[model samples]
Target chain A: MTPPEPVETRTTTPAAGRSAQTATLAEIAREAGVSAPTVSKVLNGRADVAPATRSRVEELLRAHGYRRRRAEASRSPLIDLVFHELESAWALEVIRGVENVARGAGLSVVLSESAGRLTPGRTWADQVAARRPHGVILVLSGLDESQRALLTSRSIPFVVMDPAGDPGVDVPSIGATNWQGGLAATRHLIELGHTRIGAITGPSRMMCSRARVDGYRAALETAGLPVDPALIATGDFHHEAGYRQGLELLRRPDRPTAVFALNDLQALGLYEAARELGLRIPEDLSVVGFDDLPVARWVGPPLTSVRQPLTEMAEAAARLVLDLGREEAPVATRVELATSLVVRSSTAPPPA
Target chain B: MTPPEPVETRTTTPAAGRSAQTATLAEIAREAGVSAPTVSKVLNGRADVAPATRSRVEELLRAHGYRRRRAEASRSPLIDLVFHELESAWALEVIRGVENVARGAGLSVVLSESAGRLTPGRTWADQVAARRPHGVILVLSGLDESQRALLTSRSIPFVVMDPAGDPGVDVPSIGATNWQGGLAATRHLIELGHTRIGAITGPSRMMCSRARVDGYRAALETAGLPVDPALIATGDFHHEAGYRQGLELLRRPDRPTAVFALNDLQALGLYEAARELGLRIPEDLSVVGFDDLPVARWVGPPLTSVRQPLTEMAEAAARLVLDLGREEAPVATRVELATSLVVRSSTAPPPA
Candidate 1:
């Protein structure tokens, strides 16, 4: 796509039949009896100027049609990183990735979340807009039409990370190959000579969850195995949810000998549930998980799971947004990174 | 203070001196021979307007200085949450607290960190200014005068958490009673019948570290015990740092019977170092920690540490910044919260 021409300095000239030209910084300075530099500094939200002078300049800027341009320039290097609030355990890794890239690029990042039941007035959109950050990185569920329109109209650039639903808008995105990772996880279980494999998935509304489910099915089908619908349980991608679902799956009349959870947190839950039921990790029920977070190593019989390149993804996202901000060109791009399977003591062949 | 008089409408009319009052929706509609309601909807960032008409209106607004107020209001609600680059195990808890409140407040937060070493053209200050956030929440340390000056000039309302040095400028702040917490921790060790207590602290440049040192000295004085300068060692507040310091203290000719660490991560390091030296906690040596983070529970013998109200502190910081953003506000405010001691298995009487 062609880059838009560089924006010219704002003008205040008026043609015939038009009212007087819109006010300029020079005009506001004249009205406030201050130097143009002082007016510019105040409008940019500089704090060093005397409070009285700052207030007077702000009043004049509001009264006139003067637009503050320098502040926009100074504030564009910062990006707002948005996520859905859950346990911070997993989110921390993602944050580490984003922070590394942003800092490396001389960019500042701010974090926010849209967790808990949705509420009006105090929505994530309101908080982010109130801050007026340069670009936004949303790790969230779907956005309604109104919310999408709100961002588009404001000309704010954004990139979505691990979205829960179809992003709907055409924007740059970065995510892992969830489907591929899921298939690899299932294949690992199959190689362990486990035919009865159960699965715990994230909220089905999320795209990554759906992809993982597809991967599971594809793996079973490829191996000429009949997929049992009863073996699949959905969770909220949380430890508690994983525990609940693990218990329910284990209680089934024909319980599977192996289980694959969509995330490490859920796998941890499954571990607790298994322990409660007098089951040993690999001896009784082999369990596998995704997202090899830090906790994976510390748990008893360390977790066998798929590890997403969280830090790399974060760095890529930060770079993508900074690139978008530096150039006036608009480009829609999606970068899908790879994942690897980490084999630990959590998985073993079914007890003979 | 008395409340200001309530105006019928918060919106102020454009002063008469401004060019033709920059034709607004109503005036534009009158000139375009269209209804004011239609013009209003179009200017309000509504996508329902036909593309042809939308472009027409945009062009007209650009020409007539018809500023689109709603356009700015509709942007994403994301905020930037900044931090220093050093990675710590306990930082997760602090981040969780920030995310929890920000999500509850309906804001999305982005995470960014300053690189450890200051480099030309790629400073955290530049990143912050470029982001143009509505406000900033800085977790910074060891900022030089130039960096501080840049932030000050931005006039962005920011709240500093665990700042390294005296900000010198007026800004909202929320800090734990580090000095008091330190005293309490050291005092606990003293009360446990340990006369010779060693201490490990973070970088001395940090205010928290300095306060903790002061507390350690005060506790010894209050107990009528002589303070030993040889017993104090400084670490970088890392597990490895703690380990190195622990080894050093253990080798001292007059090694103390007990040790107090300024933070949990440091304490964990002490645990490791002791284990390597075949010393058992509370048997051969007693140890106490600060910041009762989640990992504090998982350690072999759960850690007895000081618990600071991190979540409350984050919420208070958010409130402070929001208050600053209001139309009218007080000069500035400072808040100090308390911490408590949690008795776990890590600490006991010095060995007989």
Candidate 2:
């Protein structure tokens, strides 16, 4: 944080001609035949400058006011956010949310993926510990006792985002209201006079998937209808899985009149399956999806879906992690954002 | 790295065991009432462990033959990959490429975005310096003199991918043949018997954008056709830009028989424009786009496009950066992957 060192002044020194008073580098741009930033780059000795341009700017600098000041706190304050994967719009949505908040706070966000492993490798923890980020956000990820201890011992706070598995009572977490979303979707179908409904749930082990299934049961129970095991199926939350599973559902002789897919990807797959079977959506069968990603609108019939506040939840998680690092910020154990039903073109009354 | 310290040898001493032979930890998982990873965690002494589970796993460890070995490396070797933005599928494709290679190499990939700025902020370089990654791969990004110097001083190598502007001759980089991609896309339009072809160009300042426009010109020249200056329009390489510009192009009294969009996003926008004008694709106006993104296949009446080898380019860039970090590896100045034309359902002979 010291003042810039003096440079070799030439015969064209501003002190001789222009008084050198109020000689900001930007003023020098007019005389240097370059942009102000180019002049600034020359002043700071940035190497990206072409050698010829460098000399011209340096010549102008010799006759003008140019000073380079050391930036306070040379070390950057960054947040480490790790996911199991990144090649999806869902991950992008979360990244946008974190970046929006981080940028406003003058902090940069760093992203990493654990290569789709069920648990992160020990090396990831080791690097995070060494980097000593201000805080960490684990998306659909959790730390084992050792990794948690490593970060805790370093006084670095971390939060779980949409925990894939139970993060336990002690871990701070942020998630959307999965059960409510599922309940709302099912109720919409029931209100449309659809009692024979089918469901495609995400991986049973994921907390959100389990809660959504639970919600489905809750809605059915509230309607005084017994849950049918035959009507429930499992999906891997992918288009291919949805297509295969949807085909299976459609092929059944007693197939339900409506299908509820847990995610848009799977619902799109169901659409493909329905097309192959010559069954039009909302005409012979009504379909609903969750997550309400942008693709929902792009699809042919525009699926009815449950809108999960993914971005808002991500923002909340990011803020919570940063707040946990602040001494005065009260830490909440759990945060649940709301989810609601978005009724679009895909759902209607079941077949006459 | 050092050998594991000797543990307490109370009742479960290995010397007092019934042949502590062939007792791998995986074997211990069956008897310990826990996962193999949990046993490994106990062995690693990670702090996130519950006392009860730790004790149970420890008992199984002592009863069976559980021994700890020194890990070859405590910290993961991470490579920094920076982008201008992550909200697009183009970014995701690059990520997938880098992750694919990094994972196989037993290295993790850390992602960062410069918030769409031409150059990353000073803190980004500081953080990378602090982390001391294996190397950095910047996509459509560059470093100023100081940031480059900081990395070079630390012996941290970096390579640019699809550089936005001319990288100094000294820099190693990987990119697709953008000019060729543009040439192919435009040539396809001409081959469709479209004499009055219009085009939407990407941002004029970007290197790829300029190259694509140049290719368009070259293609028209090769076909012995005069390039129309008024028929060419500039875009921000986004959907909205395409929609707005497409509308302008479509509204012209001498509207083109066909239009070539610079990217798939812009092509989708053209679809929107055509829809708004009640014009059917391939019948009223032909459209061809560059960057055969996945959406190109899914759009109504799939689009014909130039396929830039984005994933392969990214993989090459990642490997190049890592290679630059190796003391014995020779550096290549620049690497250009090939681009090809993918003809699908959207294109046809200019509205017959």
Candidate 3:
């Protein structure tokens, strides 16, 4: 195998630092001190571009290394999107967002899971290389060193969406404000006069889950409550995990009057657990969930949730991936969308 | 614009009938009176293939036109999986199944939608051709005459999964026993002593929706009950549509004691309509749904549903696409997986 080629952030080349922000065609033209169409002509090798101007633009192109159309007349207009799993609405929302952008660009989106694993297997990269897509998008996933080099070697730009882990300082990513979402969810319960609140955090290994837990802790500290390790329970972000951990939390002699689940699925599990325990929602135990998936609104009494702007996050991620694929494209190394509270019938003042 | 070439199936060329069924290298080898590996050597242009055997194999290859690997070692290994839309758990299940097979075959699955349209848009075929994937699988979708001809012309065999329209005599497809699913759902209700039953169906344009409704009517007739046109309401297979139509049926003083919904989302909408009207599931009314989606088991009273075997159908579709991409694959023009009834808490004998 070839020695790992030093990729974008590893080198001091102009293109390496271009990940700071995304630039447009006009910006590339202005930087090269030429008209936008002239730069376009040079990029497309139209012969009308002055040789001197062409060389100047060419140097800028290498420096910026923006997305260059491989072939305008006949190009494979497909982008590869890889996910850790496609078993939930979260993946669908991302697909919808990517499709919106891809359709407008006259491009097609091709989806793949990371081969039944949390990360793209080595073979996954090889298949991606085979497809030779214009770019790649990894959702809730990360790439190993070799996989990163493989994609980079082939010049296939990729964007990380809701990355499960820290994808490094160089990898461009789109995520929601998880910390704020957790904070808002906790504050809502506090505003409803609940102090002894329990929390169900998703798997700690995931960055978003950890961020939410941190936000919850921050809110409790701001309210002058000691952070209770006992009140924080761990879950895998699935309904069964929620039910199992929710039971552990609810059965306590000092059970909280309110609880915050890291995700809607877990909160739903709590609902079943509550029912099993004969607990009436809000009146006996208030609940708040995150992600605000469609089911949140239809559940009995509905659910109070932290809306993560999943669709918008996905759309932004799609845009980011498209931008990254452009030659001389300014790259935003990271982007985060806003998350807000969606209050519904699932929460209220603690029992008087 | 390039003139459309009259494609396979339209011509008497050997490649035309090749769409009849994909044959494998082994089959081609047998027909050519050579060993499988020897035939492979001929296709791969290995020097060892005897000249006489090579010519014979090549002739057989043209006759069968089995999946011709364009430079096997360097060929793009991506398979295209297109969807009408990706908004539901139904799509996710299919994705999961496709990924499972694609992984094992050392191929990656690329997903595309019909350019944000319900019908596979005209440009969709062009995009697939540009990618030149190993094969194509369409979920709950069909290709127009021109689209089919274009794919056939390019030797890009495609299999339709759960085709929404008649795929015709030439096109290969995979589908569930929708009529059987509907029959089972209705029979379950009837077995519970429901004579005054109603049905909510998906859009009539969808073949599955029509077959399901036909099954419902068949079940009612089998039980010696008149099928009331008033009780059969139209829906778009969505929650709001189900709620609106459910409300329409429930408002009648002669409302059904048991209602069969074509899908889980619509069934959930009926749950809401019942709640809004101060009714209870399996008490004031009984509900049966199709597509045992994950939400089916988690609802207030777990929904009794007709299992469409979406995952299995998807897996089968994935396998079919791979087979069509092989050298001498046996062609199965259409494949239908079985559908069965899943009894849960939502269905009970009609309240007296």
Candidate 4:
């Protein structure tokens, strides 16, 4: 294992004229044409302030780069963990990881779901700012410009875990080696003599899903196997999508003998699809999945999957955000932990 | 569906001579021989309070049944959700349920795990008191006397979800009909012509687990079958326990034709054990499980099990706690939601 290499690029660059010196609360209030108490109320997330005054005060605070003192910023003994959605066993793994770190640090975890939205709503940001938690960790979720600015103005650091979209160069993040995981999953199938391999991709918007499919393509190209577009099916990283797409791929007269699913949920769906089609695993079809969730081992035929360290990644993300909160220096760190393939009963040589 | 019955038993009883009137803060401070500010600090869970003084003041508060005014109680727009352990998909389901209610109420959730401890530690109690959320929801976790006094002093209402222990008659709790679930699961197997049936039990320390085993025994007795103590295996409600105990049960020369696992995870473990023993599900051995988790349907031969509405139970618990916080009246509520059998592919007539 190699050490984490420091990239030349930073996560976020400060606006021009940004410096060690920052404007005071009174100065921000004067610029916004509001009283100091009104400015304080806005900062405290009190709902009494008018919307117009609050917006103006917020803008001035951002423009002046007003950050509360470290003592004032971390009043609550909390670490915030936000998720795109709380579905499946995946969220549980990440929550446990964050909880582990928070407990060690003598801090509690504040959990929230973006409720299927890619970004948390504005009210969430306001509540987070008001509570003044030590740091925030986002899983498969990102903040928009204003939301980022809001947290930045208050000096509350945040780190993303397995970013769904490219979370800008300036945002610190922790992710798994999804590309390598995809390559390993495909190569294992190739080694098992499956030239005609089908691939099921996660949501197109998620970079992790895209990386896996790209790695699958690279493996096929490197191994002198044709990358048939027809065999590739799109999925939302859900069981239903996997079953639906798996049926489509399997029904073809020239169906692939093996499939690589983006995640374990999809792989289980593929298992169901194969069962409905009267196809025996290994004998009629071999399957590989990513994110070796606990159910992977318990499934029939025991899924062969790429193991992404989700809990470790969450721990890293939490720790990184806390570190960012402590240090004055900007750290543009993006760490990708290693991923490896686990061979089990699910994968075998394709039938002749 | 029957309406929730109002039990004659109340959760917590006030001490003798309790009345509508309560001791003033100044009076309590005078009695504890501390300054008003110092007494206030203790109420706020400040670390600066001397341990002896804090304990003395806490005893007075409990004796007087001092309850903070509702106006001063709910300062934070948050709800505390404590778990016994955040280990499996089960926790995720409960989290979602609480999150749903919290979101609708415009409140965020503060999640903490007791880390396998039946009750949260003193530190957790202090933190919850300081935060002063709208209410507290304890999932399979309860508060001790002192911890209860601390919350009661701060007027922080809490409701237990599926109490791990007896939880006393005075604690408001929401739980599933565990005995009914067990009966349904075992009866399903019995109806399938399995006279010789094996049972897996969760930890006997937990009331829910004990209820399940008792229900299993009741089913056997009602069927006029001899209760064979040798056929019942004890587990800790985990997959590994299921596998270990399952092996012990299956290895017997006169092994029962069917097995009823305490939970879905253990049932999955039983599947693995049967696979290792070269026995096919339903064909060679019929199985039934409780808590129809999503994986129950996705697993091979889709488990025939009892559906415990874990999410609904969590939602109900959260709402009940919030209701308790709002009303001045003490609610002696213990709701047990219905559980039903969900028969799928895992159960069938015992093989000849």
- Those runs of model 4 whose alpha carbons end farther than 4 Å from true positions after fitting are A1-22, A72-74, A328-332, B1-22, B72-74, B328-332
Off by over 4 Å in 3: A1-13, A16-75, A328-331, B1-75, B115-118, B327-331
Docking class of 1: incorrect
- Residues B176-256, model 1: lDDT tens digits: 899998899889888889999999988877788899889989999988999888889988777777789999998778788
* Model 4 Cα lDDT, one tens digit per residue, B201-290: 888889899998888889989999888999999899899998999999999999989999989999999999999999999899998988
Ranking by lDDT: 4, 3, 2, 1
Residue B279 of model 1 has an lDDT of 85
List DockQ for all candidates: 0.13, 0.09, 0.26, 0.42
Give the per-residue lDDT of model 2 (tens digit) for B71-159: 22322267788887766678878988887788777566667779888678876885675455677999888998767755653456788
The true-versus-predicted C-alpha distance at residue B206 of model 4, in Å, is 0.8
How do the residues A183-247 of candidate 3 rate in per-residue lDDT, one tens digit apiece?
99999988999999999988787999999999999999999987889999989888888889989
Model 1 Cα shift for residue B203 (angstroms): 2.4
Deviation in Å, model 4, residue B276 alpha carbon: 0.3
lDDT of 3 by residue, B1-352 (tens): 0111211222222445446545666777788887876765554334466778866876666565554433233235667888887767788888889888877886777778774455687566656654556788888778876566556545677889887778787777888999999999999999999999998999887899999999999999988989999999999888888899999999999999999999999998999899889888989899999999988877778899999888889888878877766645646768778899999999999888
Q: DockQ of candidate 3?
A: 0.26
Chain A: TM-score in each model: 0.76, 0.78, 0.80, 0.93
Candidate 2 structure quality by residue, lDDT tens digits, A27-146: 667777888767654543334689899667665554443422222232135678888777556777887788777766766666778777756887677556445466789998788866
